[model samples]
Target: MSLRSRTAGAVLALAVPFALAAVPADAAPVPEADPFVWTDLTPTYTATADYQYEPFAVTDGYRPIGRCAQGTGTGEGGAGYHYVNPAHVGSLDPAEPAGLLYETDSNGGRALVGVEWIVRADNAAGAPTLFGQSFQGPANLDGVGSVYTLHAWIWKDNPSGLFAPWNPTVTCP
Candidate 1:
């Protein structure tokens, strides 16, 4: 081989390690803190905000659509629905749920079931993701329109799956 080629190859070999080392060791796509982690750290915060906010109220653009326990995907006694919040279109919190799946108590109080995400961005151009997961459009989940949505069992575990729309573990009151 020519000296020129050998020298070029030698330079690349020496720079490879330096380039690789420049990157952080924990550069993996894993999230630093997810719903479970945040809720564990601040259970009261999650509960308080969820119950007080009443994200699923009729005024919140989240209409009751189904029930999970009896064939629907909503909670046992409570129900879930298709939701959209134009006001919070691009909001996202790595340490908290962008939205909450709620279950009503016997006393008519709201309880936390899981977390939800909904975006009304055009083509989801500004949608957000958490825990290294991306926001999927209606094409992936059950929905229609340019909006995107996702559900995570960050507060409660879902035996069926973590990303399942409903959490079988969260029973209604």
Candidate 2:
């Protein structure tokens, strides 16, 4: 074969694998939004050594205030809400431990809270996992079919204000 022909053949061989690896034009593309978007993952927060202002089922020198992945909606007066994953906190105080919570907008952006664990992607069946005071979920638990629920807490010190559920739209993968 001519030198130029041989070189062309070698280049084609090297490029074949990469071309096959490229996303197929016919293949369905993955969604850009995080499936967990608008879905409550978990909550986290901060607290003093005394665990004052915060409470949990366990008192092993840890706080249960962790940050949430996202908010149910613009929480409490247009302030979005974020869910906390208590399992993520483990033995650390949400207040003292930096980034202990996956904070978001809530309570007029004045109040932030977290949850103990993220329910299964489909919430199919599980006791819930707690790694101290935080928890993490797979990028797409249901492997592209998973969905999440954004359960949140609404507090009212006064018993005179009307109450409504806060819901909002979020991206999903």
Clashes of each: 5, 52
- In the range 1-173, model 1's lDDT, one tens digit per residue, is 96544544554454334333433575543342233433332432332232333543435444433333322544422224333334444456533333456666567765555556666546525656654566765433233345556665543445544455545555543
lDDT of 2 by residue, 3-117 (tens): 5445445544543333234434665543212223112121221131122123332343333332223434444332122323334322233222222121233432323222222
**All candidates' TM-scores?**
0.45, 0.22
Model 1 / residue 44 / CA error / Å: 11
The lDDT leader among the candidates is: 1
Give the CA lDDT, 0 to 100, for residue 91 in model 2: 27
Superposition error at 3 for model 1 (Å): 76
Residue ranges of candidate 2 with Cα displaced over 4 Å: 1-79, 86-109, 112-118, 122-147, 150-152, 157-173
Model 1 TM-score is: 0.45
